[model samples]
Target: MSYLIYFAIIILIPIYAQMKVRSAYKKYSEVPSSTGMTGAQVARQILDEKGLYNVTVEETPGVLSDHYDPRSKTVRLSSNNFHGHSLAGTAVAAHEVGHAIQDQEAYAFLRLRHTLVPVASIGSNFSWILIMIGIFAGMANLLLLGIIFMAAAVVFQIVTLPVEFNASSRAMDQVVSLGIIRNDEERETKKVLDAAALTYVAAAAVAVLELVRLVLMYTGMTRSDD
Candidate 1:
C-alpha cells in the first residue's frame, strides 16, 4: 500500500503540475494584464525596481520552462512567457521575479538553499552508489551513511519550500501593490502562481519519500544483522 501510494504520488504530482499550468494558461489566454505587460516586461519591471541591474530576463525554448539562475544572474523564461500576455505568463513572470526579490532581500531560506546546492548535488548524485555498494557488501554502517546523505537532500528540499513560497508571496504582493492588474486578473494570476507553487511542494514530497525509503531499507538491513 505504501509503495503504491508513493508511486501514485510521484506520477500524479507532475501530471497535476502539467495539467494545472496548461489549464491556467488556457483560461488566462483570454485575460490580459491591464498594463499590456508581457511576462518579460513584468520581469524586467520587477528586476529594475529591485535594483538587480545585473539580472537579465531572456527567452528559452520549452513550455513553462522558467527559472532563476543566481549564478548566471539570469531569469530564463520559455517562449510562452517571453512574449506571453496572459495570466499564465504574468504569474510565472512574477514568481521568477519573486526569486530575484528573494535574492536582493537576502531571504534566509534562499540563502540556505543556495549554500546547500553543492552539498545536495554531491550527496544526491553519489549517495545511491554508496547505498548500492553497502547493500551488496552487507555493511550495516553504510546504511547510516546513506541515511546521512538522504537527510542532506531532504534538508535541501525542506529549505527550498520557504524559498519558493516566499517568492510567490513577494510576487503576489508586488502585482497588487504595483497596480499591475485588476482584481479579476488577480484571481487568475493567483491561480497560476498557486499551481506553480505546488510543483515545488511535490518535489519536496518526493525527496522526503525517497529519504524515507532509504531509511527503511537501511533499517531492514541492520535489523536482519541483529
Candidate 2:
C-alpha cells in the first residue's frame, strides 16, 4: 500500500505539471506579444542590457527546449521560442537569460547546484542499482552507501527549487523593466513562467519522495536483520 502511494506520487505530480506547462505554452504561444519581438531578440536585449556581452543566444531544435548553458555562456532557445513573437516565447527567453544573469552574479543557490552536479549525476544513475543489489545481497554497508548517494541527489533537487524560482523572478523583472512585454501583458507572461516553474517543483517533490521511500526501506531492512 505504501509503495503504491509512492508510485502514485512519483507518477501523478509530474504528469499533471507537464500537462499544465504544455497547455499554458500552447495557449500563449498563439497570442502574439504587443512588442512584436521574437524570443531571440528578447534574450539578446536582456543580455545586452545586463552588460553580459559574452553570453550569446542561439536557437536549438525541439519544442520548449530552452535553457542556459553556464559552461558555454550561451542561451539556447527552442526554434519556436527563438523565432515566435508570442507571450510564451518572450517569457521563456527571458527565463533562460535569467539563468545567464544568475551565472554572472554567482548566485549562491546556482553555485551550489553547479557544485552538486557531479555527485547528483552519479547518484541518480547508480543509486538504484546499488540499492537493489545491496538489498538482495543483505549488504548493510552497500545499502547505506546507496542511501547516501540518493541523499546527494535529493539535496541537488532541493537546491534546484531556489535556483529556478529566482530565475523566473528575474525573467519577469527583466521583461517588465525592458518593455519586452507591456504592462497589460504582464499577467499572461507570468502565467506562462509560473506553469514552467511548476514542473520544477514537481520534479523536486518526486526526488524528495524517492529519497524518503529509500530511507524507509533501508530502515526496514536493518530492523529485520536485528
Candidate 3:
C-alpha cells in the first residue's frame, strides 16, 4: 500500500500539473487579462506595490520556466508567461512574485528552510557515501549513519511544504488584492494557482514515503534486506 501510494503520486502529480498547465493556457489563450498587461508588467506592479523595488523582473526563455531567485533578487518568468497576457500567465507570474514577498517579510519558515539548504545539500550527498561504507564494511554503526544522513534529504523536503504553500497563499491574496486579475476571472486564477500548490504537496508526501521505505531497509526491518 505504501509503495503504491508513492508510485501513484510519482505518476499522478505530474500528470495533474501538466493537465492544469494545458488547461490554464487553453482557457486563457483567447481572452487576455482584463488589464491587457503582460506578465512582466503584472510582476513589476506587485513588486512596486509591495515596496519591493530591489527585486528585478526578467524575461527568461523556455515554457513553464518561471521562478523567483532570492539570492539573485530576480523574478524570472518563462517566455510564454513573460509575454503572454492570459489567466495562465497571470497566475503563474503572480505565484513567482509571491516568493518575493516572502523574501521581503523574511517569513520565518522560509528563512529557516533557506538557512538549512546548504546543510541539507551536504547531508544528502554524503549520506549515500555513508550507506555504501556501511554496506561494504559490514559495520552496523556506519550503515546507521548513512541512513540518518540520507534521511536529512527527506526532512528538507518536509520542511519545504510550508514555504511553498505560504508562497501560494500570498500569491493568491496578492492577485485579488492587486486587482490585476479581474473579479470575473478570479476563479480561474485561484483554480490554476491551487492546482499548482498540489504538486508541492505531492512532492512532500513522496519524500516522506521514501524516508519510511529507506528506514525499513536500512535497519533490516524489511524482507527485502534478506
Q: Against the true structure, whose TM-score is highest?
A: 2
How far residue 203's Cα lies from its native spot in candidate 2, in Å, is: 0.9
Q: After superposing candidate 2, which stretches have Cα over 4 Å from the reference?
A: none
Candidate 2 lands at a TM-score of 0.97
* Residue pairs in candidate 1 whose N, alpha carbon or C atoms collide under 3 angstroms: none
TM-score of each: 0.90, 0.97, 0.84
Query: For model 3, what is the C-alpha lDDT against the true structure?
Result: 0.80
TM-score of 1: 0.90
lDDT of 1 at 183: 78
In the range 1-226, model 3's lDDT, one tens digit per residue, is 9678777867786677668756766676556888888889889999999998999999998877799999999999998789888888888888899889999999888898888888789878898888777767666677777777767777787787888888778877887888887678988787777777766776677666656765766667334445
- Candidate 1 lDDT by residue in tens digits, 134-179: 8889886886786788688889988988888898899889888887
Which digits, one per residue and each the tens of the lDDT, describe model 2 over residues 29-85?
999999999999999999999999999999999998899999999999999999999
Q: Measured by C-alpha RMSD in angstroms, how accurate is candidate 1?
A: 2.0
Which segments of candidate 1 are over 4 A away from where they belong? 1-5
Worst 10 residues of 3 by lDDT: 217-226
What is candidate 1's CA lDDT for residue 162?
Answer: 88
Record all residue pairs in model 3 with backbone atoms less than 3 Å apart, i.e. clashing.
none
